[model samples]
Target: MSKVALVTGVGRRIGIAAAIAERLGNDGWDIAFNYWQPYDERMPWGRDAESRAELVRRLDRAGVRSLAVEADLEDAGAAEAIFERVGAELGAVGALVLSHAESVDSGLLDTTVESFDRHFAVNTRASWLLIREFGRRFTGEHGSGRVIALTSDHTVGNLPYGASKGALDRITLAAAHELAQLGITANVINPGPVDTGWMGPELIDTMVGLTPLGRLGTPADVANLAGFLCSPEGGWINGQLLYSNGGAK
Candidate 1:
C-alpha cells in the first residue's frame, strides 16, 4: 500500500491540519497537503508564511516526502485536481483527512446568501467531491484506506460554518458504509474549542471555564486523535462522530 495521506486546510503550522500532517509524517506516511492563502489572509489571525515553511522543513527532516499544494477548495474542480497532482507526486493516497473550513461568524438573520453558499461549497461540496475522487482512485490494500473529517457542533452565532459541518458529518459518515466494499473506515471528529490563534483572551477564558479541563484545547491534542484514527488500530472505529473535547458542555 502507498502510505500517502492527503490533509486539507494546512495553511498554517499552528492549525490542526499541519499538526496532523506532521504526526502522520512521523508515523511513516508521505504527506500531501492542500492550503488556500486567501482564506488565511482574510481570517482574523491572518497568514503565517514562515510557520508553513517551517512545517515543510520539519517534514523533510523527518525523512518523509511532502508536497504542498495551494488550492482554493471553493472551486469545484479543485478536488479532482488535488488528487491528480498528489497521485502524480506522492503515489496513491491511503488516507484522506479533511480539516478545511469556511468560517465567518454571522447570525441566523444576518448570514448572507453568498456566505452560506460559499460555506457549503467549500466545506460540504468540496468534501463530497474529494471523497468521490478518493473512492474512484483508491488502490491501497483492503482495510488500509481511511477517511477522517474534522467537524463542529457549535451553531448558535456561527450559522454557515456549523451548518455546513453538520452536512459534512453526514457525508463523511456515509462513506463508512458506502465505501465498505473498498474496506475504508470513515469517521468524523469534533475537536471542541481548540484556540489555534482564533480566540481572544476573554473568549479563551470563558471556554476554559466551560471545560472541566480548565484549559483551551491545543492543536496537538486534536492531532494525537487524528493520528490514532488513521492508524491500523483505528480501523475498527468507523461511521461514528467522536467528540474529543475535554468534557466541555
Candidate 2:
C-alpha cells in the first residue's frame, strides 16, 4: 500500500495547502486533505467548490489516490472525523501537514474574547487534537511518522492569529520530545507573508519592499520546504522552526 499524507485547509487551488498536497502526491504519497467550505466562503479571498474540485483532479492526475474531506476544525469532533475518513479511504497516515489556520485580523486594542477563543479553537486546539489522534493511530512498525505545521511569528495587527500559532509551536515541540520513541518527528515552518489573495495592492507592495529577496514568497516556496521535511532525509530534523522565508527578518 502507498503511504498516506493528511493535509488540512485545502479549500482553494492556489493556496499553500493545495501546493503541499500536490507536492506530496508527486512524491508518491496518497493524500487525504481537509477543508472547511463555509469558512473559506467567508474569507476575504473566497473559494468556490470548483476550484477545490480542480485541485483534487490535478492531484488525481499525479497518479496517487486522493480524498478531500470537509471538516470544521472548530468543532470538537472534527479531528476524529478527519482521521476516520482518511483511515477508511486511504491507509494509515505516514505524514500530517497542518496548513490550515484562522487568519482573522484583529489588533491588540480591538481583539475580543470571542475572537480569541475562536482563533484558539481552530489554530491551536484543533492542531493538538489532530496530533494526538495521529500519534495514537500511528504504528511504529514502519520507518517513521512526520508532523509539520505552518505558523507565523508576527506580533501586531495579528494578535489572535499570532498568539494562537505560538501555542501550536509549543505543542509541536513537546510532541517532538515525547513521541520520538515511537518513530515520530514533529516540526513547525514559518513561511512569512505569502500573498494568497489576502493582501491588497498597498499591503502587497509594502511586503515586497520588506522582503530581502526582492520578491514576495510563493506557495511553491513553502511547498518545497514541506516536501523536504516529510522526506526520509528530514527524519533527523525535529523540534525546530524551519524558516523558508528569504531572509525576512
Candidate 3:
C-alpha cells in the first residue's frame, strides 16, 4: 500500500526538506507540503507565492498526490490544520518531516525574549504539536511509521537558533523512546550550510572550504538520507541525530 507523508517548509528551494518530499513522492507516497507563504515575502531571501506555485507544479509532474497548504505555523492550530487537510485529502501519514521554522538571525546580545519565543512558536512547538497530534491518529495498521525533523549544526553554537533546535532535538529523542513500542521511529537530520536561501553563495563557498566534501551539501544529499529513514529498511535506526553535513564535524 502507498504511504502518506507530511513535509513542512516545502515550497521554492524547499531546501533539504523539498528533497525529502520529492524523494517520498517518487517512491509512491502521497505528500503534504506546508509552507509559510505569508511570512516568506518579508525576507530578503524569500520565495513568494509564484515561486511556490512552481514547486507544486514540479511535485504534481512527478505523478504523486501532493497538497500545498500556506499556513502560518505559528498560528496556534496550524499543525493540526495541515494534518486535517492531509487526513481529509490523502489517506494516512506514514512519515512526517518537521522542517518548518521562523526566525531572524540575531546575535547573543541582540536577541530578545520575543525573538526566542517567536522561534519556539514555530520551530520548537509546531513540530511537537504536529507529532503529538499525528501520533494520536497514526495506528501502525499498515507498518511502523517514520518521523524526521531537519535540525541544524547551528545547535552546537548554543545561539538562540541552535538552542531552539537543541530543544527540538531532545523532543524527537524522547518521543522516539515513548513511541518505541508503538512503531513510530523519530529522528533528526542536522545538515550543514546548504545553498538554501538562508545561506548565500559566498557562505556556501566558505562552508565548502571547511568541509571535506569540497562542496555545499545539496538537497539531494539530505533527501537520500530522508528516504532511507522513511524506508522499510530503516526501521532499526531510531532516535538518532544524524549529521548529513558533507562530513562537517
Candidate 4:
C-alpha cells in the first residue's frame, strides 16, 4: 500500500534530508515537503523554489506523488496548515519528519530570552504542534506510521543549539511513549558534525579524522537511516535516540 510522509525544512543542503525524502518516495510513500525562506546572508544548496521544485520533479519521475509547501513552521498554526494541505492533496500521513530547524549561535552569556523563544519556536513548538495535530488524526491501523525527528548531538554538549536539540530529544522520547498507545513510534535522529551545509568543510574534515568512519556524513547517510526507521521493517524499534555519527564524541 502507498503512504504519505511529511518532510519539513527541506530545500537545499548536503543531501541527508533530501535523500530521506527521495528514499521514502521511492518506497511508494507520497511526500509533503516544507521550506522556510532563506536569508540574504547565505544561500545553502541553492535555497530556492527551483531546487525544491526540482526535487519534486525527481520524486515524480521516481513514480511518487509529492507536494512542497512554504511555511514558517515556528508559528503555532504552521503544522495545521501543512496537515491541511496534505489532507487535501495527498492522504493520511504515514510518517512525519521534523527536519526543519537551525541555531543563532548564541552562547550561555549571550543567550537572551528572545533568542531562546525563537529557537524553541522552530525546534520544539513546531514539532510538538505537528505531533499534536498528526497524532490526533493519524490512526496506527494503517500499517503503523512513524514520527522521525531531526536532532543534534547536543545531549552531550552544552551549546545553545545542542540545548535546543536536547529538548527535542526529550520530547521525542515522551512522544514515543504516549503515541505508542496509537501504534505510532516516535524517535529522534541525532547526527554528529555531519558534512551537511550546517557544518563547513574544515569542521567536517576534522570530524572525519576524529570519527571511526573516517568520513564525514553526507545527507544520504542520515537519510538512509531515516528510511529504515520509517519502514515496517523497523516496527520493533521505538522511543530510541539513534546516532549516525561515525563514532566521534
Compare the candidates by lDDT and give the number of the best one: 1
lDDT of 1 by residue, 1-249 (tens): 559999999988888999999999999999999999999899889988786688789999889999999999999999999999999999999999999999999989999999999999999999999999999999888999999999999799999999999999999999999999998999999999998888889999999999998998899999899899999988899999999999898
Ten residues in sequence with the least summed lDDT for candidate 3 = 152-161
* Superior by TM-score: candidate 3 or candidate 4: 3
Decoy 1 TM-score against native = 0.98
Candidate 3 ranges with C-alpha deviation above 4 Å: 155-158
Rank candidates by lDDT, best first.
1, 2, 3, 4
Off by over 4 Å in 4: 39-46, 140-143, 155-158
lDDT by residue for model 2 (113-187), tens: 999999999999999999999999997444479999999997699899999999999999898988887788999
Q: Report clashes for each candidate as comma-separated counts.
A: 0, 0, 0, 2
Candidate 2 lDDT:
0.89
TM-score on alpha carbons, each prediction: 0.98, 0.97, 0.92, 0.91
Strongest candidate by TM-score:
1
lDDT of 3: 0.80
lDDT per residue for candidate 4 within 167-213, as digits (tens), equals 88888889888887788998888777776666777776778889887
- What is the lDDT for 241 in model 3? 95
Ranking by TM-score: 1, 2, 3, 4
